[model samples]
Target: MMSALEADFGQTPSQTVGPYFAYGLTASQYGYDFDQPFDAVLALENARGERIRVEGRVIDGDGNVIGDALVEISQPDGEGRYPQTVDEARSSGFRGFGRCGTGTESGNRFVFHTVKPGAETSGEAPHINVIVTMRGLLLHTFTRIYFSDEAGANANDAVLQSVPADRRGTLIAERVAQDGAVRYRFDIRMQGDGETVFFDV
Candidate 1:
């Protein structure tokens, strides 16, 4: 009797988003806008916490800028409380979420202006969850952006500890300041050396 595993079977071809993805996803390009706001301005006025800037670039395996990648980030307010409802988010001036598309002309650079997030809980370190989507990706990738300034908290963070010691630096963002305003720089590498540490979730 022949084993079932001995039979030859064809493999399915992988699918890709291909070109022209922006027509449906990007509002500024084709006006198909989602109901929620994409910019990270949690509030226009009376918003709590210190305002900060986050910026970065998206690069591919070959070291070329992706140029059209879309990044979404979810973070709590400075107090670490997420709004329970859309109405509450709007009223409390806590957007707690944002999406940004890398610039095609500007070499895949993205920027977000929002308040510095606090720890979600007493024990957890302050971090922002990120999701990336782009052409050629069969599934989206997930990662976390950690603050370099939180050395003590990061050392004790459960999630950070779970990652391999050598790869943990990929998740930490570099801190910079301009004109007295704080900024964090985090670059995403899709593959190859120095590739970002993506999470299973």
Candidate 2:
């Protein structure tokens, strides 16, 4: 399981960044189940590793903030899904799916404060793929989270289909909604959702 799973669209051809501190991953896990269109901009860290205040507006099905929901990010590396030691978690971060970095200009470094993406091509498909880059690691790796709500979709996702049948369930996320919002927080277990292998391309 890749920790710190963030989603960012391909650059629009005009974004540039310099080196900065890593404050770990910002939590943008979705807690809404309806067809909500939310737009959120989570905080970005300064060179000092402080949380710069930012806003994430949860969009309603009509494309508006039902109200604003705030999210906090936990360490993206190994909170148990990807197991590592406390000391190692401090020194390296990800000892499973990936490692943190000092931000790069290439296609590797990525960060976002967007809602958990509904699966592509199928609403029931409850999962999103991720690329992880933590300390001591150099390659972008792939992992997934499946939605418990969408079993049929999980069964049909082309990528999920590609994996061995038994291995497929490892990526499923439990969908639990509360306070009128849909929430799916499936931490990736570095040992494959507690014990499985991830991928890199």
Candidate 3:
């Protein structure tokens, strides 16, 4: 009873791989007693550079917030250098990495508390690398967050420049100051209008 396609060797079926990330990766935030390797906070009191909050929600193609999304970010310290040893990270109070889940926060947003990153190279702009994982996705997507305040540096950034002129805005985070705190909003749109520009790598 095998058809031509099934008899020949049809492609394997794909499976959704997420909506279960919190139980394993963000257990602490989900009220699990397990120790999490990292959390939303990436900087301590002694951390150098300007401390800022990055907040945003992951929106689906239908424009609804994705509550079960897990977001991870990594970036160099303010001085554009990464800690090569545990001592350096402890002394600086900057771990250069963070992870957050949208399910715990109101409005289903992922917020990262850390210092603004500096340009790693002369021709590069200050940016935070982002990774997004959620349900229905077989593979996670990668993107970068560039600050709206860094106009000059962003203009010269090779990676940002490589993206098409119009689509570049999708990667820029808007700077906002409220209640005497600095925050940058960078929403990730998975599809449809204003879809974020995800890199192949």
Candidate 4:
């Protein structure tokens, strides 16, 4: 028998992230009736800015698509302003945040309907901040989606410049046009060659 003090002395085991994110944080995507705080649509039809779609899949080290991944994104409005209140968000029809689960869509892809954000500051480029949570990950990963067409801004972005030149491409979303819609493809590779550059924060 262990003493009371000894029982609590061992290090806690790390827990793997699981599909709970899809069933909980993104409950609606999985057909749950629970109220979803946010969905893939971040910008409504009335939202200001150039409408764009961000789409991608999460790939494992072996290149297999992870269908249970949960992706979240937050960004400012076109003029580089974020809504400060619920009324403002409702009036603008742009929440500036979104969440999606890969399993909900065909091809195990996650998509966000948003507008092209403007530079929030002189040192920063227009980019959408992303957080990924999936099975086997002990902690969520952080990354950014930089538009490939924003060449000048991207070239001057301090954060993008911090990443190595060869690896910076992983952070850029390729521009693509389909069915008269603008879409950006930014696949996230968890490991192996061409892995995405995840931030520690």
Clashing pairs in 4: none
- Candidate 2, which segments miss by more than 4 Å at Cα? 1-119, 122-126
Off by over 4 Å in 1: 1-23, 29-37
Residue lDDT tens for model 1, 78-156: 8888878988887877788877777543656777777778899877999999988876786889999999999999999
Give lDDT per model, in order.
0.78, 0.37, 0.91, 0.91
Span of 10 residues, lowest total lDDT, candidate 1 = 11-20
Measure candidate 4: CA RMSD: 6.0
TM-score-sorted candidate list, best first? 3, 4, 1, 2
Once model 4 is optimally superposed onto the true structure by TM-score, how far is the C-alpha of residue 28 displaced, in angstroms? 1.0
* Positional deviation of residue 135's Cα in model 1 after best superposition, in angstroms: 1.6
User: What lDDT is reached at residue 133 by model 1?
Assistant: 82
Q: State the lDDT at 111 in candidate 4.
A: 93
Q: How accurate locally is residue 156 in candidate 4, as Cα lDDT from 0 to 100?
A: 91
